[model samples]
Target chain A: MIVKDAVCPFCGCLCDDIEVEVEEGRVVAVTNACELGTTKFMGEKRMKNPILRVGDEWKDITYDEAVKYAADMLLAAERPLLYGWSGTHGEAQCVGVHMAELIHGVIDNTSSVCHGPSILAIQEVGHPGCTLGVVKNRADLVIYWGSNPIDAHPRHLSRYTRYAEGFFLENAFRDRKVIVVDVRKTESANIADEFIKIRPGGDYAVLSALRAIVQGKADTIPRTVAGVTREQLVRVANLCKSAKFGAVYFGLGLTMTQGKYKNIRNAIELVSELSRHTKFTISAMRGHYNVYGSNEVNTWMTGYPFGIDFSRGIAFYNPGETTAVDILARKECDAALIVGSDPAAHFPRKCLEHLAEIPVVQLDPYPNATTAFCNVQIPVAVTGIDAEGTAYRMDGVPIRTRRVLSSDYLSDEEVLARMYALMQEARER
Target chain B: MKVTLAMKPAAKWFIPIEAESIVPKNFLSGTDLRVWRGNRELRLDEVFSVSVEGDADRAEDVEVVLSGDTFRLKRVGEYLDAGKITVLGGIGMHCGNFMSGGTIEIHGNADGWLGREMAGGTIVCRGDAADYCASGYRGGRKGMKGGTVEVFGRAGDFLAESLAGGTVIVHGDAGDMTGAEMRGGTLVVHGDCSRPAANMKDGSCYVYGTARGMIPTFKKIGTVQHDGRTLIRFSGDLANRGKGNLFVKGYEYLD
Candidate 1:
């Protein structure tokens, strides 16, 4: 049977037009989704039961025992870390926050590594952004700065910016312009009308020069700014000004560069400057499907987007200090609960060293890199496949992911609810 | 009163202690106070061997001296409106956060966010200072609104980021994005710095040494004499308001 309108729980695009053919409780084929989303829909080798590490090997454990053990460990810990909610649904993320507040611990998400810098920049200069639908409808000029959507978010162009049918344009594909800015020529750059290659860590300098050019200070700018000629800068500035509506989408390449958040701030300020002449907007090309949801929930519930510390019984936020990477690397957390995302695959070696020392509990479907560090690993249903919940898109649009198949395994929300229930029980005592 | 806190050895050296209440005014109330190790709150005496040298009537008369592995202690003088704090060795992150008045002296190296958001008083770091020194909190519009921060040694990245109103002086080479987004302030770097006074609207940044990767927008406005040295003055970052002044003895661009 084909399940229609299932959200692909992969990239931040959160494509909801997926058609999944499931037979005998497993996904056999998928359509209307990218290669990355198709792979997640047809995932394999899911653990049947929860396992605990005894000495050097694994020991099968009941769900009740696992939940109780996780609760007891968190209750006893002085500084616990609840991390990795980006891969899960919003319901599970809600429970995670309450647990952190109750346990007096730190709660952070995958954004700390990806678009956290973008948020920092937005806080400083304020974001001037619009939804993906708005960009597809009205934007005549689309700039993919420091991002290669062709390789990462494969359907981004076909769905929204470059190839998507525009509502206002006479000829959507013919009239819309595409520009790719990066340190190197990427696959996405191949299709762009303009591909401006830059020097490594030169994004900040380049951005500053463009801002000056936009402000009519072109004469003050040097002949070349960060490998881009003054002529090219002026041309780009003119293109932005001439366009009726422009949209900019940036990725990790800009945020993780030398200046980090300052680069995004400059970009936003540039957009603000260009807005005086034409309509413009800027948005982050978020990585995970639900990472934006994590930020949304955390912000509304705790006032901060991520890297929140409840150690003082009130939510105290400081990103660099309370973030997961800094917490693990500094050996601040004695116990850790990892839900949905893998830290061992991404975290630095220093953080892995502390992960090895701490007692860790993880809730995931497959045995990923983080499984190696977990003393207790519990299997759960994957969102949009056997489980369904709300997920926020890259542009902050909420879509309720539809379930495609039946599964014996519990969902992330069910598993976390069990843990939170036990925690509440222990707290009342 | 002179309060002395000598840190005691801990089983876990990695877990830091937060003693934001260690300021002189808090001590004027009584010897009783609280500090945090992770989520666990402990008596001030639990982490340190506390002693009172004398009695005082006002906050200005009280001074706090910290010794022994104080590098792991954080927020030593937060919200310090007055008084003085002296760290014998290296100090930790947020040594004097949001301090409106008083003085903090660190003999050894200081960590990130040293003297952060200090509205008044002075902080003298005899050793090298880490990132975000004399800067604002994350997402705060203004930093170091009014105060003085002097680092006798080298400093790290984003030094005095978003500096609004204050004076910061560094004797050795400073790091990237110095005086970034500074709207009102005076910054002096005795040695070289990268991308000094970036995106600043209104302020004065002086680099006695070479300025590397000079932003392209700042317009050259001839030369001027500053403190017996003939420096090149530029009116920028023209990218923004183009009102800020940048003075550099020498400069280089990535061009």
Candidate 2:
């Protein structure tokens, strides 16, 4: 058995350093996998059947025919849009971007909807962040604001946040103070010694109150402020001011909430403020394993994260203009090529409605909601299952994902390269 | 009417949409509306000429039935203008997100951003809503305006952050930061809450129960009862010159 360290491409808590036992061209077993990771590793998706539109009904076609058909479609499209690269690797993303540039297409990813807000905040105000390894080792005070990693990133607690025994925090959770601030009582909140439940959309007020208390302007709080009492507000603020090393792990709570960017900005500002007194940082609880990697690649390729438009062959950043939800809801793009995402099962109703109106293409290793709606569907090999590539963990740590089985299909990188070649061929033709 | 949409035997399976009044005019039947999973992006405007096609209705109220594993619908109103859309089962995130007009009632739970950055619409959830109800997308500042979201059950959190306008009523308990940096709007909570109004510049939060904590910035004026509900009034998120009122009811029960 050949054991290799790889990142678990599950949720956002991209737990790298996972050891996979490969035996006889098969993944005999995997170590350090949580419930979510186990599910992702074991979940075997069925291959999709190739289909070409003859008149109204789509007929199954060969893989060669499908690839040729997809290439032809991209070459023929006047204004093509390529989207969805959250689950793949940076190399694949690079290839996809080049394909978009070759075709002059609008290339986007799932972050346009998921963490696009966080990326925007990073651009506006530099993100005060560190790797999860640093957090696992140095952080003594861990605050989960509006995010429950237990349900989302199942192994986050045991692997990185609380239980993981690091160099500095030898006692791990015993030496740490866990504070969970949320609206309802979550599984994580239940275990937290200090659980502050603010009313929904009340984070901004709570953060400000904490900031005020940290600044020591006021002592006693009013009887009511954003549903939280003055006393409890002080407790949370004091936690931030007094902690030697603190980290705030926020999720869709800060971004998608009422404040949106303002909420994130405030949270980031709060962390910045706390850092003045102590060492504190904030990290967005990204969803997909490579979401942050996607952001990095997107930023690297176009100097923008998500919601980028390349109509002028130059990247333009506009959340309201180019974000997947906004772009689709407004009916902006003329054609779209989706890779490894299920927008039909993931996007908002408005965006999905607009998507139903366009010419769509899908490429993936399995059957999904977005592929079911494509004008052309191309089946590709699973990245970590049937193909090998490099992917970044949520913490920005690069880890190689190894293929565990054999497959005749191409990788996402290969597919994008083929598309790029086809686009070039089409341009020449 | 029972509309059963299964995965067509194609390489990719998109959503099978069958509406009562609206139908696509001139596109391939299974090829028009498409869906995919894994790492792919689909542009909304380029797939089909008409996204949704349904028979125009005059019943003053119409219920569109959607059945699938997880369906994400965007620009739902462009296809058919109806009084109400009731989702019987679990829906993907942003069920009625960015809806300009109409009422959407989700019978089952929705993922996240139930009515994200909605300009106008009413979304009522009988089940639990995941995260950021009637709020903005990940980074955009503007949130729901001219809309109402009433969650009968529990909510995830960030109930109404950066809300410009509208009313969100969570009948059950709320999560954290009920009204974070709210500019204008109203959040009504009926159960015990932690903090109802956080950094709210302007807005009214009426908590029918006692709050666990309150920011020191707000000044409690007194208590008032309106429409058979006792409300504890508070003013000033003072940090941002906010005159927003945070009202906590059932103060007597809160030792």
Candidate 1 at residue B237, lDDT?
A: 89
Candidate 1 lDDT over residue span A54-81, tens digit each: 9999999999889888999999988899
Error of 1 at A73 (Å): 1.5
Q: Each model's TM-score, in the order given?
A: 0.99, 0.65
Interface RMSD values for all candidates = 1.1, 9.1
For DockQ, the strongest prediction is 1
For residues A1-429, write the lDDT of model 2, one tens digit per residue.
645566677777766657777666556677887877766766665565566666578788886677777777666555566888888877888988777776666778888777777776676457899988888898889998888888888887787787889899768869988999888999999888798887776776667666666767455344555677887877778876877899889888777776566567778877887888999989888888777777788778888777666655667555655577766775555567888677888888888776766678788777678865687787787777777777777677777777766767788888777767776877787
Candidate 1 chain A weakest ten by summed lDDT:
A163-172
Every candidate's lDDT: 0.92, 0.69
Best by TM-score: 1
Worst lDDT window (10 residues) for model 2 chain B?
Answer: B17-26
Note the clash tally of each candidate.
2, 104
Candidate 2 yields a Cα-based lDDT of 0.69
Clashing pairs in 1: B119-B146, B145-B165
